[model samples]
Target: MNNPVITIKNVSKSFGKNQVLENISLEIHSGEIFGFLGPSGAGKTTLVKELVGLDTPTKGENFVLGGKMPSLGLMERVGYMSQADALYGELSAKENLEFFAALYGLKGPNRKKRMEMVMEMVQLSDDLNKLVSNYSGGMKRRLSLAAALLHEPELLILDEPTVGIDPVLRKSIWDGFYDLKKKGTTIIVTTHVMDEAEKCDRLGMVRNGKLIAVGSPEELKENTNSGTIEDAFLVYGGA
Candidate 1:
């Protein structure tokens, strides 16, 4: 069996009186591309946030890379690209990359090499000297992805990464994901797009704070007697 990179054991989260997640349990295998599929407000972000130790669960536990979560030591092994473009708009793209590289403890030749590689991967190498404030929405999204990949982390957590990207760029980005998978990186992506869900090795369907189903795209479609992921999702949501 493949080693589990991320494990959630009956985890739950609540904000004030609002419950965002409930008894969520999952295990993601190493080198696999896992998709957390759901419509907006389905707690996909909440679940992924817990995996990266950004937000602690109110109940149960989350283990990442064989250690209990919220561990700074473990964080060094994870790369996260949030939905928002968390970039320093005043800085140049290269400057932003340099800053993040330092935070990941990268230095000297390794930092420069990794920065160059990620910039190329995101097709932003030529824009290195451009100020982030002048970038388009799609460019900012790509820059965020480059920043997350700067450390060459073992696991990647991306939340709606392709939202503002064009189809051509999206294809290039997915190609990059396959290249990372070849290098033994575990990737988790959250999205509502059906076509994107089809590319995942396995998917966890979330609805109203509950994980309604978990399986490969084929398994889900077959079991639901549906032709598409959207149809399967409807069936699972009803159950």
Candidate 2:
């Protein structure tokens, strides 16, 4: 916590005339898995997209790894995996890795080593030669995760990473997250799943493009006099 890896200050975003984020402000410390929980259209993805510099805030500032928003220089130190799969269908898994790894300025031995390490972590080492077009939804999700970790980035931003993944595989992926955290990687994940929210070191519950609560899972439930995160969210929603 000595040096926070990510900071958002009064950040807001809009597309055309519709506001997607409203004065969102938060901090993500290094070496932690922080979860953003919300229903669909709750601005979880918008906030994360802003953090990754894919979209700029309309009114405020966002800083990652100490640099201001949308800085090309900071891209190498941050890894991002959006909810949508962004892979080339014609490319083999290994080829896809090669392309993205190169984008992060990786080459030679470092690139190969990282590529192998990420594939192994995602339990897809054997599928390196498979064409992505043949991959199932879960397989593609695993591949996306592998690609995101290929750079060993100091900060990881994952959006609904486990949506289509099976429970066993999902647990393995979360295990990988913890291992990365131990190695000092700051991870930010957006999910609506309550169980996943409970696993985070801290959580931000958002609704209608606004943050309703920020705390550890236990703290949130206790504060709301609820037995679970879902219950707490309901209380916050005045249900």
Candidate 3:
């Protein structure tokens, strides 16, 4: 296995009196797709935010690319797609790509090439000139994913990336993810979808701010004596 690209040590987070995460610790290695599987309000997004340096833990620490969390240099090496679409309403799809590409220091021919490449990867090449405001919910999601890939970052962090996408397009997106993984891009995805969870190389199941289980889909099922990832999750959740 490659060296650990992400390390979380006894991480915890709290908002006012509510504790969102409690004593979470995990190591994510390089060049694999790791999934955080859990339902809504399970603190999956909060954990991911910490990984991307968008939020800091109230306790413990997070390290990415061998650097401490919230490092500007390390942020450049990571591509993040948040749950909300962050796009210019009046700008065309191409324009949005151009803006973000520039933020990553992509310029001239390189920027153009990357823009085209990511758009094609997300199957949005034909909609390059469409205004973002006019794009449907699913189209917006795809565009957001394309923008995240524009920089070809070593690590890709996606939070609920496939939500609102149709089954056919969702499969296509997953295929693209596998291609990225093959190229040594470590991916961290948070999803409540069981089928998607099974596609991950390994999974960390979170519930009520705790990591309940950690294993590959097959290993999780076998260990829990269950037939599916969902069943394994249920067993872990004490269902």
Candidate 4:
């Protein structure tokens, strides 16, 4: 087994009296694709935000690369793509990438190289000169993904990455994810899409702020005596 890449210990979060997550505990190993499978409002985003240090857990902790989260130093080592697109609508796609690259301390040849590389990965090279404000919703999402991958961080965390993408583009994006895994990057993706969840090496089934099951796709299906990931999710969710 690979070393632990991320460790979530009894994590919980709340907004005033509205609880979002409840004692969620899980471990994601290095060089693996780990998925958090749950429906909307199932607290997937809340839990994910905590892992990326964008939010703090009201209870428990999130450890990444053997150190505690919300650490400024760790930010450079992680690539994060939030549920919302974080691109600058006023700037051209290339300009946005340039800004992010500069912030990551990338300069000169290396910055140009990475910018081209991620654009190729997302198949957005041609659209690089276009202003983001004029891009379609799906194009914006792809550009956001390109920016997240700008630095080739050791850990990649994505929230509903393919939500607005077409089937062909989504497949290609996932293929890029598999390529990254081959290069030994630890990836954590949160998705409500069952087909995407099945592609994960292992998945954590979260529902109603609780993790109901954790296992590989086949393991989950067999354990639940189900034929598919959706069936397994239903059995685990008690639906």
Candidate number with the higher lDDT (1 or 4) = 1
- Summarize candidate 4's per-residue lDDT along 1-239 as a digit string, tens digits: 56899999999998999999999899999999999999999999998888888999999999998889999899889999999999999999999999999889999999999999999999999999999999999999999899999999999999999999999999999999999999999999999999989899999999989999999999999999999999999999887
Instruction: Give the count of colliding residue pairs in each prediction.
Output: 0, 0, 0, 0
Question: What does candidate 1's lDDT look like per residue over 1-239, in tens digits?
Answer: 38899889999999999999999999999999999999999999999998998999999999999999999999999999998999999999999999999998999999999999999999998999999999999999999999999999999999999998999999999999999999999999999999999989999999999999999999999999999999999999994
Cα lDDT of candidate 2 equals 0.92
- Between candidates 2 and 4, the one scoring higher on lDDT is 4
Best by TM-score: 3
Quick one: RMSD of model 2?
0.9
Candidate 2 lDDT at 128 equals: 96
lDDT of 2 at 179: 96
Identify the superior model by TM-score, candidate 1 or candidate 3: 3
**Candidate 2 segments whose C-alpha is farther than 4 A from its true place:** none
Give me the runs in candidate 3 sitting further than 4 Å from their true place. Answer: none
Local error of candidate 1 at 222, Å? 0.6
Scored by CA lDDT, what does every candidate get?
Answer: 0.95, 0.92, 0.96, 0.93
The stretch of ten residues in a row with the least summed lDDT in candidate 3 is 1-10
